[model samples]
Target: MSTHTSPAAGPDAPAQPQGGRHAAGPGRAGRDGGLGGVARRVSLGRPGDPRWARPGLWGVLALAAVLYVWALGRNGHANEYYAAAILSGTRSWKAFFFGALDAGSFITVDKPPLALWVMGLPARIFGFGTWSMLLPQAAAGVAAVAVLHSAVRRAMPGGYGHAAALVAALAMTLTPITVAINRDNNPDTLLVLLLVLAAWFCQEAVRTGRMRALVVSAVLVGLAFNTKMLQAYLVLPAFAPLYLVMAPGTSLRRLGHLLAAGAALVVSSAWWMVIVDLWPASDRPYVGGSTDNSVRDLVIGYNGLGRIFGSGGGRGGGGMGFGGEAGAWRLFNDIMAGQISWLLPFAVIALVAGLALTARGPLRDTRIALLLWGGWLAVHYVVFSFSSGTFHPYYSTAMAPAVAALTGLGGVLGWRAYRRSRAWSWVLPAGIAVTGAWAFTVLRRSTDFVPWLAWTVAAITVTAVAGLLLARLGPRLRLRVAAVALAAGLAAGLAGPAAYALTPLGSAVNGTNPTAGPAGSGGFGGMRGGFPGGAREGGPEGDGGPPGGTPGQNSQQGTTGDAVPGARYGLPADGVRGGGPDGAMDQQMIEYLRRNLDGATWLVAVSGAQGASSVILSTGLPVIAMGGFTGSDPAMTVDRLDGLVSSGRLRYVMTGGGQGGPDGGGSQVTEWVRANCAAVKASEYGGSTDRSLYRCG
Candidate 1:
């Protein structure tokens, strides 16, 4: 087998497998016939790679599948907000395309519809259910682990690349928050997958100098942009510079390629937004989060700058401070640390160490890998740390890939330094010690949950650190000492996160804020509350109210709601139907609405998506959200309601306490309903006092 290295990969780049440019073909088959050949090709690994490399990659993927897909149905419409959208999408192609909260296309979800399109297709085919809605995210999560491994493996040199890739994949698979998000229907799961895939393509472009690869990466970024809007472009800072510095070709040509790629990015990202913005507003659902009924405004205001500058027209208006006060320590705070920061400190140390170690290497040295992953970490760290927006702990999933990659690379680099350079031997032990200490601190925050694990991790850290340090002094015993040190160090580093990651398997996670671990496990304490009508604290039993209910009220009534059986989270198991954050309507209300559709275009109009989502899910019918997701978007007006009512398209209006916007303010539609519609007695529909049904027109 011959080896070929791209000029950009440098002379020291890892040797490619046989068959020259078209490796993983006859060259591999002819040398290692039968199963061995298949394994080599399946792994896409180098000739010197160990046999375990293939199985190790497979093992990581298997672990991820279990973490993401196991008992997924138990979640049962995890994030019913998105689940309702998926259900709508399953029933109506228009709703699917627009990410509408209802089949009638009254309002689109706050973000774009790509994720809905991804999850919707499966749900459409499989019949809408918990598994169909969430499985795509699980598959994407596993694929992300695989891609991150490939990116790290290809960037590092020789057999060490395989080891690093395995470590990176495992770290990502077990990163508590990553597990939680993948198990849910949130767009961030797909966003992380796309960003990592973009990284993989960028790494390929750097290695091969292929303009096509770079362009593909840019397209993936654009798709990611469509998935979550502005959040996808965060990788540009890391990707563009890495290619500019190390991609093969003259500076001018590389710049030209990037310019072309940037053009591709703009086109792919804007196409949908353009289409939506240009569509006649009356013909489509109102752009959910925008103050004006415009996709452009929604993108630039609610989903874009609103997230960064904290001034927008959506719910919380980006100033909700859901992830705690933004600062350098935000990621390490109790609300977030258990979710993603378990390996963050070590990844940072690894970044610094890896960069310093490769400082003198050629332009395409392994330092490019460090910069790619390190820059990603730095950019997200800064933005997430300081962005005073409506943040959630699951938002930290964006940082997991970078942190995992750096940890793997840094670990390999540290081991190599320890073996070859006496002066740098301390780097390996230092990283492990710091990681162990941080893990202990994080574990202590949940002492009751895992009383013995913190001290056990501390003891292992001391042993591993001591072993690694002493191995430096005794050359004869070094190999044995280092082996034990490596095992203990890995255990010490992964133990805390692995434990937290398993918590989701034991019980249902909060679909809305999807954090790992049992309640009070150093995760966000107010998970149930903070959203518009959700309770402020103490799960569903607290005084703040059932999700989507008025403050100081509990509207759970009737038979157990449509929340899938086995749903252990705060979701109402009582006869409350409409399983959304705006609070569920009693079964009788759903029945009344169903029986009285009577040629009405919509079964009912409610205050917000929170109020409308559950009804849409329960009835599989169109309902109108008078306001949008946050209940603040000017999606509805008194005139629109009167027109619909007069046209005999809207017959029922559910208004009052639980239906108000996030700010507890009522819209003109609500006022008009109160003035012109006849209120039905709560006893008639089995509805709570806080929520009354008004018959209009």
Candidate 2:
């Protein structure tokens, strides 16, 4: 909805005094009841002067929460890799902070632990029900929607600005990948919320030129860093520059403030890193995913530049590279485009028009907002598009806010500019056309995926462009024209993602690197690991099927050339089940380990995190994930195993060939166990060829 305020009253308009003098600049609108004052006055008694404003906003938030929280337990440990960690974290504070897969602190999860720590608290209080584990993510989703609204409102003032904020909030809430990620136990929900907070604080800092607000913004982003490491820094380049340029201080003062803020960022981001590093390595679990048992190396190598350039060394989960043989269009290709990039074209267009229209005047707070969000989107876009490391469609969740913010804010302002100049009116139509056209191109790749989308977008584009051109002939129908354009434009953007969201894709998304969309739409042609004609799903350990298995074989294919009866622990292609034992590992497998391994310090030692987590989560017993996630880590050697067995500390050894796991150790461990230990038959564990339990002698 585009509201046409007088040019002088526009959010970008220079403030003017009633008496005589022209006001000095843009951000001082609060004194005369600007965006800040208007926001402050609103309450439950009077959410808005129009009566609907307060209730409408609250209603949106409530609805978003319901969507995020309702039946969330159905997801049932959506991503098993993380699900196992949540289970472990709930059991022990040490495991929680270290992201250990078990209470014994064997090996930390690949990423930092802040995200797990947040999820752990509720699970501890409520027990490890799926709802309790997933509640934090759902709550974060609601808060992100609310904070994003506030951030946009502050950046773009007036009723139109409020409308923009509302639109942004809705867009974010309904985003397919965002909705999916939020409903699951993924860390992305917290990451998005913290980023929104950082944006809001940065907006406040620019509005007031107060260093404290800037510092707060930096701190929030630093916390985000703790949540996801290098991924959080992507927004800093946009944020820091916007603050320096838009802030009202002298150059030196602004520079000094930024310097202080940078210090704050470093301190906040690295505090955990420092604590974990300084803590004795002997006390903590080996940092999973690092060649050296150092968290710092994990940041610089595996999770850092290794993501941009393929892993130069093999120790990290760095793979053959993203796109595999698919090439650079991977993200824009049929499998990924509909998941998150639907609005990208419109956002870019709105950004150009909004900045161009406002560019002539002194930089207003809205312009700064545009720069912050737009730059954030651009840098990430380039990185995701070109990066050679492991990537997923779900990773695009971080990009959603920027796309929504720019579109919502820019759309309103662009419309206002369009009303004033006939030339500017073309910008809106042009943007919508490009967006619709791009969507058509992407959708056409999977024509059968969403049969009606391309035509619906085409019709809407034609109708929208016609209406906008018709509005040029008269003034009376301008609002109606704008409404048509807005509706049709939104229809163009929302059509594909909405369709994709309806699939079982949300729960079906799994594995170390999980992409979302219709199953086969992704690069390799079908679901990774579990589905037909695709790469076998591997965890943080390694890639390909279990050793000696075919490339496109399902996880049921075992190394011994026999069928594994149960679903792979983290590789279920079906929608997550509600309540009871649902997930990759069969319940009987968990029971067998539980019944036979009484009084044992370790329930079993599995080849990788996937197998070990399957049992640990089910039984809440200590299970060693030898070789860590991908199974390459030398977490425990054969000598240690021998000692444990001899001392009766561990009684059983379970073996399988895991992707990226310690297969290099060869048949020695498996061979040694077979030669000496009593082998528990598959009949005792039901029908899976993958299962082999050895009673260590």
Candidate 3:
């Protein structure tokens, strides 16, 4: 290949200086001083940046806030599982640090406590409620958009930087899955933010040649790991290589810097695991998803390799059943495509064309931008495409940042190629054609949903492509024609996702497997089976049923036993009664527990967190999730149960709620409870005959 630089890849004027050290230069600071200066700087961006830059960034963030926080409490406690943990954390520092499911610290939530800590401290000050628990996630989502803008802007210099940055931020903010995940309490929201921040820091490292920036980027990745284990490391393939290739230094020196950053990553990621593992088992809650009550096993097993190879049990044994199957087309499958694939086709084209255009440029050429985003997309695409373990559509939120960044970068590069009359200018119209077709196909999948949309997208795509090709013939009209074509292309590209992204605003998304779009728009809507006691057979209208059922029955049945009524996917709506795993808690049961608690630390002990969560959230009392999340964890032993009972720390045990039954040593505890404890009648507690409450002392 020729070593000559492509116009698209050649050095351009820097929009912001390296290291951001000179962002507020002496002359600029002197002219605009004090808090007023800071405010102006914040509102207008750096003096060097375009006037539209900061305002566009704020607009993107404002959009994100509206999308994420508008109907924030519509879903109530969102994911009651995490909401319960956050509630507990607010009550006790131990629960806050360990991510315990109850105030009494019975068992920790499956993931690390970092996300819990982020939501918990605020809940502590604000008092736990729907808003307090989920607002932080919304804030994190907005911050992720801002940081992604900065990263993309930093990578592309001159006029292209501002547009690319704003486009990337807007793409991220409007991504359907990004909206769904950020609105709920899942750790994925914070994970996306941290990973995006890491990417920004890595860009800073490359721009400034500052080793500290690289190390900070590594530390951010470590924090992301704590937010969601091995999933966070997915960005490493993107981050490490970018620094090694683009950072200014000799190979040996760059390698040394990477090693130091690697060490920092290890320390930051391992510190919590180390402390938790070192704590005595007797004094701490058992690790919820591990075979052994050790954080190391939790990481190495359930949260790590098990999530990839599907071995260590829990939910990872069988795939989450949401992502269709393990194949390359999985992301585009009915169950997943709407969530994150709306812009994927365009992104792929961008990556290839951008890379080919910049292939001959110097090391620091913008090709590294393609490598960073493309590598991020590639690794996640492969793993998510093939990983046979516990996968959900929401997990694809991790891929949104890469897709958004690539979409922005690729669009700009393609535009640059077109403007410069490069041979690859055809790639621009081709990308628009491909993206429009894909959008039409995806929109067609939801036949009844805005029937006109698919055709509208197809029409726009045709018009945009024709205009682009025609613009080439008339150089005088090229600028105006191409501008309109590009705008139409952007509209066609974003229309599908933008429509799907709005669905969550109107309906309550399933907190567990949060997928965007109208009900049955590829989400696992039918998965909301009625819980054991009184949970209705199906969910709300437009919410698809599980497999086979009458359309009306499927759409109208309330999520009673398993799910909170009025909530999608069976999650509880605010003010819904909290009884057992099924949201079937009776007033009688609440009164019975209140009267009988005596001086016991626990109000009741149930098989799983689902069983414990509602009760805890309702009464603000300690309810032990004996077997942790799946009720399969050996979090409870017969000996420990005996000791708690003997010491008056426990009094009641409710068994059999369709939450997984006790596995391993927990089975022994169940047997002991059955053999020795006196069973309380269903009539007494107003509970179902299927699940019995035993009064043990």
Candidate 4:
């Protein structure tokens, strides 16, 4: 590597030497007429690195897509709670537009309608099915990867941008919690998307100090607020320190931009708040988690407080917050461990090496960015750990990017350091191969390695740890080699889930229905006419699963579409059934229940996320809430509503498919009525995961 250059490779040269000594022989000239005459030097955008969005981006995309599909394939089983939100549509043409602008009154509270609308598209056109419901979250996951890449690159140092982005994307996209969110149609996906978006804008505002960017940032942040209230607001503080530190003056102008962005956020978010505000307070679900509260409290208070102090103690939750063996600091450790579980064997040593060592100045920003991102995650985790009440690990998703960025930074920095110290180049490749093998041991999924797998993983982890340490002091190249290999191995681990999703889907949707595609109504492996038992699912693409009480894609009817004459409210996709009860189960249920009970009303104790689905399915009857249940809950007020059953007023109580494993054994309400009242009749459900008809017990 000589600093000196040949006469031809003069001042404004291509930095490095061009083609072999053979040279640009013959008529190779810039203004030459023939192809042979064309002369151009290979262009490397990032100096010696030619890739733009580096190999990691594509690698991540591929992995993410693969993982997304796998998750898709593994999409809802017998469960229909979260699976059904994907089916909601604008009821009428007017509602379609108004619903888009209406905070989506029909869906569960906790967030705005943008994400739901985005996800509803595929389901609607594809016909409701099992996996089709997850498409939107998957799309959001991909977009997040892209945005994070640009943000880290432009705002951070040492060119760790690529590594940081790759890791962040990997962490966020691969996390179990993220998988849960994407599979379900809850608001977490939307909230996370908006948060990331706001952060991206924040980066822009900081880097360029552009008023427009700030305004964009503010508006997005506001939308995030609208989506999930204070959960999105956290984006401002957690991200602002670095941004403000890098500000380019113009304080007054910056203020104006911030103000404008705030205004956008408020206005956009208020569409629902205003409406919900106008309604009687009792009508709003301002207290409960999903069912009872409006979008505001769920997002602003419940979700927000939970993120800060956790919701375990009493946060209206009673489950294991972190799902581990500790609390407070202990809990934080558990979270960190879970987040970086795959990298557990080497994370610490890698961090030490990255920090105790330094690379080219070009790597500074990368390092800083990784640290900041990591800090962001750590901060959120700490907040949750110390929360007064209970909390779910999914709450820590915000920090996933940081963990990945740190790993990526470690890999890149280690490699750079090894390059600077040519003393152990041989060791580099050997260490890489070994480290890669170990990483693969930890990350790779091989049913073949069953018996010896645990021992092998443990042995490999130790050896891998040793290799990482030795690589660190041995030479910079060795360190980098190990880092790259490790990252590659972790990435490889995602293949299992990815490949599974890519497989073909079954007949989730009915071919006769027109909407259900080949294989099924949804993604690969989905079934037609819904799950084998016919459980509730998302709309359109739903493979037959319904929304609320469990029907099929058609169950999400009445909740979606605008109330206009021809605004896609009732129009079904190519071969799908119409949106309403013209010939659907909802129509049948409403008709049958009407015949069973002479009373104008019935006390319906329903569980599952899409109660709106039930409203449509059991049309005409005044289905009063027997009890406010959640997620496939089958309990009813036999003590109170039993009279309805006895007097032939209540008529029936519906049980859900996918409500519980194997009939969801512990349904006291159903049992109570069965023991107390005389069941008059029972009817089978279509595309449902559980029993749908109970004339009366």
List the candidate 2 regions with Cα displacement exceeding 4 Å. Answer: 2-52, 312-328, 504-516, 522-592, 596-598, 663-692
lDDT of 1 by residue, 1-697 (tens): 0114343554356644434423565454477678876665676544545556777898889999998976665555567678778877877888888889888888899889999999888766756766666778999999999999989987776667777888999999999989988987889999999999999888888878889999999999999999999999999999999999888999999999999999999998999999888899889998888878887887778787888778753343456665778899999887788889999989999989888888886524467788989999999999999987788788889999999999998998888778768889899999999999999998898667678999999999999999988887877978788978987999899999998888776544466778876456434423322211112222232111112211111122113452532122344544333323346666667777778889998988876776576666656678887767776667777777788899998998776435455313355666677789897776776666535578997
Of 1 and 4, the candidate ranking higher by lDDT: 1
State the displacement of the C-alpha of residue 653, model 1, in Å, after optimal TM-score superposition.
Answer: 0.8
Give the alpha carbon lDDT tens digit for every residue of 175-289 in model 3. Answer: 9888988988999999999998888788778666788999999999999989888899998988898888778988888998899999999999999999999999898888888
Cα-based RMSD of the predictions, in order?
6.3, 8.5, 7.0, 10.9
Q: Predict model 1's lDDT versus the native.
A: 0.77
TM-score for each prediction?
Answer: 0.89, 0.83, 0.89, 0.61
lDDT string for model 2 (1-697, tens) is 6332345666454222332122224643444366655564454212222233456678878867876665443344556667678777766788888888777787888888888888777767756645566678878989999898888876765556667787788778767668667766667889999988998998889777899999999999999999888989989888888888888889899999999999999999999889888999877888888777788998988788877776745544354443442355655666567667778878988898889887877447778788889988988888777777766666778999999899888778767776777768788888878877887787787666657878888888878877877777887977787677777777776676656554423233343344445556655423533221113443112121311212122222234242332234333432111111121344555567668776777777777786676566545677887778767776766676787789786888766544445523255666677777887765777735444567785
The clash number for model 3 is: 7
Residue 238 CA error for candidate 4 (Å)? 2.0
lDDT of each: 0.77, 0.69, 0.77, 0.44
What 10-residue stretch in candidate 1 is worst by lDDT?
544-553
Query: CA lDDT of 186 in candidate 4?
Result: 55
lDDT ranking from best to worst? 3, 1, 2, 4
Q: How accurate locally is residue 110 in candidate 2, as Cα lDDT from 0 to 100?
A: 82
Worst 10 residues of 2 by lDDT: 574-583
